[model samples]
Structures are given as C-alpha cells and as structure tokens.
Target: EAGVVQSPRYKIIEKKQPVAFWCNPISGHNTLYWYLQNLGQGPELLIRYENEEAVDDSQLPKDRFSAERLKGVDSTLKIQPAELGDSAVYLCASSLRTSVAGELFFGEGSRLTVL
Candidate 1:
C-alpha cells in the first residue's frame, strides 16, 4: 500500500490569514492522525480519527484549528486567522490499527510559515 500523503509541502502566509493542508492515508487504515511539530520539538498529537469520527482531539486548538476526515479516507486540517505562533510542520499519519498494536506511517509534513 502507498504511504500517507500530504499536500502543499510548504506554505507561507501572513498572520490572520487562512491556510489548509490535505492528507490521504494509506488504504485500509482505520486510524488517521494529525500531529504538530514545532521547531526543535517532538511531534505533538493534535487529533486522531477513527473512521469518520474524531476519537481524540484534546490537544487540538479549536478556536483556530479545525480538522475533518472525510468519509474516513481523506483528511484536511485548516487554520483560520493564523498566528505567527502557529508556524510549524503539520504532520499526517496513519496506522493499521490503534497505536498500541500498529506502527504509524507519517507523511512528509506540510510546513507552514506565518509572518
């Protein structure tokens, strides 16, 4: 199967503008994920989707960031009114099952630069 795929490998936007990233997880994977990685930091879980439902999103910043896994096949992460502090790499990952049972496959992240 193909690995997770993410688009717009890089983006630059002014503060307060809107930006979006898209992802397509490996076929047959039931778990889709979004992670945020800031400079010099390890990846932080932002959200996890089990099929079409968002099963875990405690770390997601609801006010400015929103995500959806459409039909459990593709996903999108959007940041509206972006802030300079939001500049970071947005990673899309997937697994055959839950984290405990399967290894995660990560895409080449979409890097955002908010000026």
Candidate 2:
C-alpha cells in the first residue's frame, strides 16, 4: 500500500510570511492528523480529522494556522505571518479508524525555516 505523502519537503521564509504544506493520506484511511515537531521533542498533535469532520483541533494555533481535509482525502495546513518559533517539521499521519492499536502511518514531513 502507498504510504502517506507530503509535499514541499522543505520550506524557508521570512518571519511574518505565509507558508503551506499539503498531504495525501493512504487509500481508504479514514483518519488524518497534522503534527508539529520541534527539535529534540516528539511530534505534537495540531489537528485531527475523522473523514471530513474535524473531531479535534483544540491544540491548533488558530490565530495563524488553519487546516482542511476536503472530500476526506487530501489535507492542507497553512500558516500565515509565520513566526520564528514556527520553524519545525510538519508531519501528516493517517490510519484506519478500526485499528485496535491505533496505528498511524506518517509522511516524511515538511521542514520549515523562518528567516
């Protein structure tokens, strides 16, 4: 099976600029998630979607970040006026909702750098 796919594996921009990353989950996976990972730390959930519904997004920074999973297939995360603190890896993961262990498949991630 094809794994989760992410694009623009690297990005660099000045502070206060806008950036976006895209993701395509594996076929038939019904759950999708976007995670942020800083240096030396594990990934932290930014948002989650069960099909087209955003079941959890409390951890997302609403002021400058937004996400969407249209048609319950592809997803995109955007950050406007990004800050230096936003420099990190944006990971996209997907899984089958019926998995007993809640296994997730992750993309290689898009690394962002704010100048």
How much is 82 displaced in model 2, in angstroms? 0.6
lDDT of 1 by residue, 78-110 (tens): 999899999999999999889566899999999
TM-score of each: 0.97, 0.96
Candidate 2 clashes: the total is 0
Clashing pairs in 1: none
How far residue 63's Cα lies from its native spot in candidate 1, in Å, is 0.5
Candidate 1 local Cα displacement, residue 15, angstroms? 0.5
lDDT per residue as tens, model 2, 1-115: 8899999999999999999999999999999999999999999999999999999999999999999998999999999989999999999999999345489999999999999
Worst 10 residues of 2 by lDDT: 95-104
Q: What is the overall TM-score of model 2 with all chains considered together?
A: 0.96
